[model samples]
Each structure stands twice: as structure tokens, then as C-alpha cells.
Target: MLRYIAFTVFLLVTGAAGADRLETSAGSVAVTQVVGGLDTPWAIGLLPGGAFLVSERDGNLLYVADGTVNRVKGAPKVSAAGQGGLLDVTVARDFTRSREIFLTFSKKQKGGAGTAVAVVRLSENGKRLTNLRVIFEVTPGGSGGRHFGSRVVEALDGTLFVTIGDRGDRPAAQDLQNHMGTVIRINRDGTIPGDNPFVRDQAARPEIWSYGHRNPQGAGLDSQGRLWVSEHGARGGDEVNLVHAGANYGWPVISYGTHYSGQKIGEGTSKPGMEQPEHYWDPSIAPSGLLVYSGKLWPQWKGDLFVGSLKFNYIARLAGTPLREVEQIKGPETERVRDIVEAADGSIWFISVGQGAVYRMTPDT
Candidate 1:
């Protein structure tokens, strides 16, 4: 069964009687509400013609267009337990011709639940989804619900990268036989990419591209087509990593943060084979959605990275050679930012779980 809601869209204006303005390092930005009355919205996909899609954590896909919000039918059945549920959504690169979209969610498997991906064609009317297909499913499902890590990114080579977490089983991150705590690459049709890191490794899963990740909730492609992810660490070690093929991110074995109980985790921070994060946050901000800005609208922010802070209620802007957080874009509207992205017109769009609304930010004129 699908649920419907009345959505309100505020007028886009700068300094227009009661407009929300956020001051930034570059300049002030006008924040306009795109839509409101959402429940735990997880991700947003901006389609052509100014319409957009929003996926709610409780298994509802919403299509907002022509000043109306309608429920998108045919979403896959989700576990919707603990930290797992319908998570990320990405529009197909050739969406105009294909009308296809991809989704990541926690699938209800035999033992418990695990992350999975599906591809479906949106109907021309945009009211329902058709041709639904389950493209990928994590093997060896876990018993608990924590750490689904369900972020999906489409690479420059027309392949897909799906991030998985340890499922609260820390040691499984080091094991290569299972899909837990790993990023897997696949073709749009769900076939394993031949160039994958472990394609020929008899003992490793053929779909594995990288391993040893804890709970990577956010993934994005930079301007240069490089992949990056925002990961959650226990206690204080939230990390932004430049993802590379076949590399180990050192989750349980090496972490800058300690256990939640205040005990030291792993053998210190640095290990020979493990890769260090490009940036990390102590006292954990609980990072989620990540975006590599194109600098189309804001030239000064070219090549900068934007990540939403789930715990701190802000958008982190990171730049420079070593990649450090340069600014925190925060206001009352940014509370519990779940996902952030660049719109077609170069405007910045983000979802705020705290506000239960979608907002667009533009340079205040």
C-alpha cells in the first residue's frame, strides 16, 4: 500500500520578506524550500524538467512535479529495521532515453537482512515504477540490523559501485569470502565487471572492488571522476576517504577513534597495508551524504567536497591539497542533513531529516 501526503513548496526568493539566508565563507546563500512534509527522507534524485524523486526510509518513493507530490509505486520490499531501510537513489545517466533509476535498500533475507540494489524504469507519467528488477544482493546475510551502508554511485566508466558495511560484525570486514564491509562494482545490468579487483581471485568474491570498510554511508565521484566516500567510525573517527581499487580501509584493525566504551580500538592508528583517510573528524559528526561540487554556480568552491553531518546538523565543505574540512555550512534548516547533491542548474540541493523537507541553496543576489 502507498501513502500520500500534502507537500508545500515555498517561493524561491533572496531576502524577500522572511526568506532564509545562510552566511558562508564565499557569500550568503538563499535557502528555499523545495518541498516539505516528508518522513525520514533518505535520498533525492533530480530529474530533467525540474522534477525530483525522494526515497523515504520507511519504503516510500515520492515524485514531486508540477506543484504536486505523488507516491511512486513498485518500490522493492525493504527490511526497514534499525539502521537499515530504503537508502540511496541515483538517476541513470541516460535518463532521458532510458527513464531508469537505481535504488539501494536493506533486503529481507532468510537469516535477517542485507543490502541490495535494484533497477527500475519510471513510467512516463512518473506516478509508478515499472520493469522492476533486483540487480544485486549481499550474500551471507547478517543477524542484526546495524550498518547497512547502502550508498550507490555510478562511476565514469558506466559501472556502478555499491558500498556495504560490516553489519555490526567487525571481524567480517577482513574476510574476503563474504560481501560484508566491502564496495562492489557491477555493470548496469548487474553483471560483475571484469576489471573488478577480485574478479580472478578464487578465494574472494568476484564482485569485490575494495574491502575493509566499516560503515561507509556516503559515496560520490569528484570532478576528475575519482571516487570518495564518507564513513562512520565508532566513538570519534568519522572519515572521508579517497576510494581506490583493491585497497584496505582498515576498519576494526586500524582506526583513529576508540570503542564506544572509551577503550582503544585496533593496533593504534597506522598500519603498513591500510590506507589513511584523506580527512577525519574526532568526537564524531556522523557523516552521511557526500557531494563533490562542480563549482558551476559558485566558482570559488570549485572542486570542493560537501558532506552532511547527521549528528552536528551541518554541511561540511572540504578543500585543499590534503583535504581538510574548511567550512561548516549550518543553519536551522540544515539539521540532520541526510543527502546533498548538485542540481542541473548548478544550485545545491539537500535533504534535511530534522526539517523533514528538501531545500535548494543559491547565491543570494
Candidate 2:
């Protein structure tokens, strides 16, 4: 049954794109393609000036404004191999004054590559990045082209939260001496936060906020200012977790999933000390970007969470305290939805990686 579902999703994601309408529980949605000709676009950051900063997995930074997309220069050299490459991009809250932006990418090093975060100043005309400097990087880089989890989210208090993967090394998730498989919290200037969980632990990385995560690709704050993350599981067990400081989310130590070879994993699912997921999926949907809905545009959807499903090729709308998947949104043009965001006007925007386009989802009249 899971294989059948996956096959169906594969067809949908690979189908030709032309349809402009999608039927949803709330109402009909008009799907408009904003721009195309992108190469494996990874994430989108909305600018205060009503533009967009888009990053491609091939290490290109693009500025999209008024239907025109231009490649921005001065991006750091990245290992554009497999899952490694330029990933998420975010603009500062005070962009008007600071013109600062944050970017996450897979940084190449001697042995292999690791997730890295940097801050740069966007030029006035959006042509290039200035003052570019890496703010945070995962240490003890290992080999392999998979699991360079890089997602950046800024807290309301102005701290930056970066999600990193285990770098295909399951045991490393339990290690505190390195930055692998951890959520790192740092100040805007790349300094460790004094209040960070491991700040006083001389043996641990001070930037570590939480530990034992595997490929956390999506991160955002809820309406109440709480951090939430969506992470990928091994064969199954895709999870939505409410992140907290000093907490440990069991990865290889305890997983609701099995090895790719279909063997049991880690002393069964539940453990005494490991934190449990708010929600999990048995047949993983390969969740990527996540956003808690405000219902500003869709009144009924307020407070719900929207997730981009790479495995299923749809948008999963989840609600309730312990989150549950309530709906899967599908349209003819819908491709592998990579990232999701709510526009200032309340409309939702998402990137379709399979189609190489950005799409707007608005209410159909």
C-alpha cells in the first residue's frame, strides 16, 4: 500500500504542468506560476521590499522581483554534490536598515562537507552580497554526499537557530563534542548565545541547543514563539517535533523506523529519556519546509501547520495539539513541493522543485 501511494505521488510530481486550479476542503485554490527556469531550487526567503531571495541546490542565489529573476553574485563556493549544496536563505527583520541576510549551504572541506551558515549584506540593487562571512559550521566533517541538513530560522528574540544532520553517521547524533546531528543556536553575529544549553559544558559545543536529530530540513516558530521542526527518518518515521533547549531527541538510539534493509532499529521506539515526536509518519512523506498557518488568508486554516511533501508531492495540512495530517493538497501543476511560506497578504507561496517554478496558492473566486 505504501509503495502504491509512493508511485502515485511520483506520477503527480512528474506530470506535465499546466493546470491552474486545485480543489481543497476550504475552497478552490488558484495556482499561478510566478517564475520558472530554476535549477533545483531549495528554499525561498521573502524580502521586506516584496521581493524574494531564492537559493538553488546547485549553489546559485537568485533575486526574484516583479516576475523577473536574476542571479545574485558572491555566493560562497559549495559542494554541489548529492544532497549537499546551497539550501535555505532568510532576510533579516530589519532589512530596510541592515540589508542583512542569512544563508545555509553544504560547505566543502578537506575530508568531506558539512552544513554551514553565513550572513551577508544584500547590495542596494540586489546584484551582489557584501560582507559575507560564515557564522556557524558543523565540525569534524565526514565523507559522503548525503545528509547535509541546513535550515535557518530566526527566533523572535533575534537569535538564529540552525538545523544540521547526522552526516550519514548515526552514532554521531549522540556525540556532544561535535556539532553533528544538533540544533545550534547562536547570536546574529555568529557568537554563541550565553544562554545556550551547552554554554557551560566545556566538553560540548556551546552553540548546541538540542541534540540527537537526523536531517532536520524544516524549521519555524509557531504563533506563540515556540520552535518546531520537521525531520526525516531512516526508512519510515518522519517526525514533527516541538524543539526545546537542552532537550534530547533520540535518533539512532531510538527510532520509530527501520534500517533501509528492513531491520529493526534502536531498542524499539519509546525510551525513558528521549523526547517523543509531536507527530510521525510510518510511510515517510519526505517533509521539507514547514509553516504554522495564521488563517489570515484562509480563515479555517489558521493555527494549522502546512508541510511540503517531497515523497508524496503535495502539501500536508496538519492541525490539532498532537498534530495529525488532515489533508493532502494536490493540483495538476503541483510538483515536488520543496518550501512553503505565507505571504504578508496572507496568501501562501511554495516552490515546486520538479517543475522548476514558484507557485502562488490563493482562493479561487
Give me the candidate number with maximum TM-score.
1
Model 2 TM: 0.94
lDDT of 1 by residue, 1-365 (tens): 33353243332221133448999998999998887778899999999999999999989898988777888889999999988888999999999999999999999999999999999999988899999999999999998889999899999999999999999999999899999999889999999988898899999999898888999998999978889999999999999999999999998899989999999998989999999999999989999999999989999998999999999999999999899999999999999999999998899999999998889999999
In candidate 2, which residue pairs clash?
A: none
> What is the lDDT of every predicted structure here?
0.91, 0.86
Task: Show how many residue pairs clash in every candidate, following the order shown.
Answer: 0, 0
| Candidate 2 runs further than 4 Å off | 1-19
Q: Residue 161 CA error for candidate 1 (Å)?
A: 0.6
Candidates' TM-scores?
A: 0.96, 0.94
lDDT of each residue in 1-365, candidate 2, tens digit only: 35334533443453345438889989888887766666798998888758888898988898877545567899988989989999999888888899999999998888999899999999888879999999888888879988777889989999999999999999999899998889999999999888998899989999999999998988888899888889999899998999999898999888888999999988889898899999999998899999988898799999888888888899999998768999999864557888998888888989989888778788887
10 residues in a row with least lDDT, candidate 1: 6-15
* Maximum-lDDT candidate: 1
